[model samples]
Target: MNNNTQTRTYAYVAAVLYAAIIGLSFLFVKMTVSVAHPIDVLAHRFALSLLVVSIPVIFGWIKIKLTLRDLWRIIPLGLLSPVLFFAFQAFGLVSSNSSEAGIIQAMAPVFTLVLASIFLKERTSIMQKLFLLLSVAGVVFIFLMKGSGMSAGNFKGIALLLLSTVCFAGYGVLARPLAQKYKPMELTWVTLMVGFVVFNAASLIRHVSNGTMMDYVKPLGDASYLGALAYLAILSTMFSTLLASYALTHLEASKMSVFSNLSTLISIAGGAWILHEPVHGYHFIGALLIIAGVLGTNMSGRKRGLVIPDKA
Candidate 1:
């Protein structure tokens, strides 16, 4: 294969790994959140991710090529994700249940699609829209199958969750040009650093004000929490995002965002396998939709032919 083809293949692989890592991360999030506050969990997760990213830089292994100007450019991208995305999500989940959150979060791909088009001038083919819609539909179907629909009383949480999705979509769209300009590791480092400082500061401020600084360190005493942190910080926060940066460098933001829904499918299967959660036939059907959607979206038949609405 040519260099372009080879790199695209790697990007595809990286996207899949990103999806798997994030898919499994929900389990760890469940584990840690049960034992600790969400902000504290996020703080520790990024602290560790930042530490891991720092080690390579400290040892002169990974040279950071970022300038002050680049930092200024990318700071918002970092905040858009680990900062705003997680913050909004952490708070959004307070009143909203998982089912409600899942349904709303499914809008992320659509948000990314629109934002990429408007800001980045990224265009999609008719086939891409169909598959992207299919993938999103898969997620909504699963959440709706869980029995609770969007509650009017959860409007606050729902709005916050929608903002979180926008932040996440913003990250995806904003990273495209930046990814073309910078290496993935450089972007990843800045992202981790931003998340570390922002989340830790928020967590610490909350704990200190409550005279509960001790609560922050208490969760680490559990070995299970430690394990959860390892997976979350090292793999999910640092590596998966690195993979995302690399993928976004090679693939269009619209195509790359579609892969995020694969995590939903993986989450369901992982829950069944590890958490012993029951899976119904709908789960299988939804998984099929997600898998087929991802495949169809990425296989590259996207041409600017006659346009069709996503639903017909």
Candidate 2:
């Protein structure tokens, strides 16, 4: 196949995988949160990723080529994308149920579109813009209309979830220029290692201030906790991060962001089946709108047939 055909195939496959990751991530987070504090769990995730990425770096498959400037980029990215985002998300999850959180988190694509428009100056078709509006409206409708039992506490969690979206939206746009220059593996390894360092420091500060240093240390004794940590660290963080970075090399951010809506569907299914959680009509409606919006953006792009400079 020609490069164009090959690239297009990879992009579609990447989109599928992106959706799968987002869907599974909620379950993974839920499991991890059961045993470890969110910060502690995220610390392990990045630490394990740091270890896994070392294999490629040591074997010369990828190299660590960090300059002072590169560290500057990685630091903000680590803070915005992983540290702050996860902290808020984990804390919010402790208060709110997964179903509500999932719907709120699904707003990421809309957030990405708006942020990209401002920071990346990426243009979108009129159809795409309308789709974005519809998706946001759908989320609000879900929150407002869904489930008579929804509480004020759930709304608070949704608020935190929206904050997480903003953090990731900023991360996605800023990451494009960095991802283009650096090999995906290299970028993943470096940024994650930076995250590990930063989060561990923050965790330590929390430990000291809270007089709960032993709480972080105590989880090591429980085999299940350790196992959950290993799964989250290795599978969710290390494996998924590498796969996403690889896919991004072959896909557009807008397309990839749209594909991310799959997470909500996956989370909804997981919630209903695995957690035995209830799903309301509004959740389904909101999810449909979100997915429709995402599809609309991609279809709009193809219809316009305008070439966007590669900012994957």
Top candidate (lDDT): 1
lDDT of each: 0.81, 0.71
Candidate 2 residue-wise lDDT, 135-162, digit = tens? 6667667767755364787667667777
Candidate 1 residues 192-303, lDDT tens each?
8999999899898998899999999999999989998999999989998899999888888888888878777776677678767667888778778877888887775545
Q: After superposition, how far is residue 31 of candidate 1 from its true place, in Å?
A: 1.5
Ten consecutive residues with minimal summed lDDT in candidate 1?
Answer: 303-312
Q: What residue runs in model 2 are displaced by over 4 Å at the alpha carbon? A: 59-61, 134-141, 148-152, 209-211, 280-286, 303-305
Count backbone overlaps in model 1.
Answer: 0
TM-score of each: 0.90, 0.87
* Cα RMSD (angstroms) for every candidate in the order listed: 4.5, 2.7
Candidate 2 worst ten-residue window by lDDT: 303-312
